[model samples]
Target: MTTCVITSHGGDFFGNDRHLTKLLTGLADYARGCLPADEREPLVKLLAAQQQTEVGTEQTIPAADAGQFAAQLRRIARHRYLRSTKLAEAATLLANAADRAAADGQPWTWRTEAA
Candidate 1:
């Protein structure tokens, strides 16, 4: 089946669908698993002592550019800190979008409620 993108005349398609949720949750799980319990959140334990001290930077959260943010999140799986944080931010953005759309009585993506 050809998965259709629901978009507008000049705006990006809404990406708060099941796919985005799955990506965000899956990456978060992997990121936590990548490290032992004591080191899952490597952001705090910055690798400042290493040669590559760059803090795994990526483009700022693309709230208006859903597709781009989603693509970037999908690519950074190996960088657990980057992947985990980006996934969380992306999920928040999508959730906000879904909330706004629902409030406006427009077509909205069904999102999973955080437990």
Candidate 2:
């Protein structure tokens, strides 16, 4: 009965502007809505830290860095959102995408290529 939504960073490339922050904000809001009040703050902090890393003042996050950030965010969400299987599924998808992109020498940006 629990619903989870993972936002996509919609753009031509990964780590474009504050896309990660927007996604994390969305996730945190969803967690607040679904999780009990006691559990929301930790999730919020996790998302906030992630946002900061994504939008670090001095350095821009590269594709690999973004992938790692996504992986960590997935872990945090899985731990916090126990009843949400979709979060795990989303995590797997993100991990797989990251792996495939690395293997193919492509950026983490989403692309549709014929198999």
Best by lDDT: 2
Error of 1 at 67 (Å): 21
Tens digit per residue, CA lDDT, model 2, 1-115: 2212222343226522222344545556655655556645654564444443422133223456556545554554566544555544544455455444444445554322111
Clashes of each: 0, 0
Q: Indicate the residue-level lDDT of 80 in model 1.
A: 39
Q: Which segments of model 1 are wrong by more than 4 Å?
A: 1-22, 25-83, 109-115
Angstrom error of the Cα, residue 18, model 1: value is 12
**TM-score versus the correct structure, for each prediction:** 0.29, 0.36
Q: Candidate 1 local accuracy as lDDT?
A: 0.36
The C-alpha lDDT values of all candidates are 0.36, 0.45
Q: Give the least accurate 10-residue stretch of model 2, judged by summed lDDT.
A: 1-10
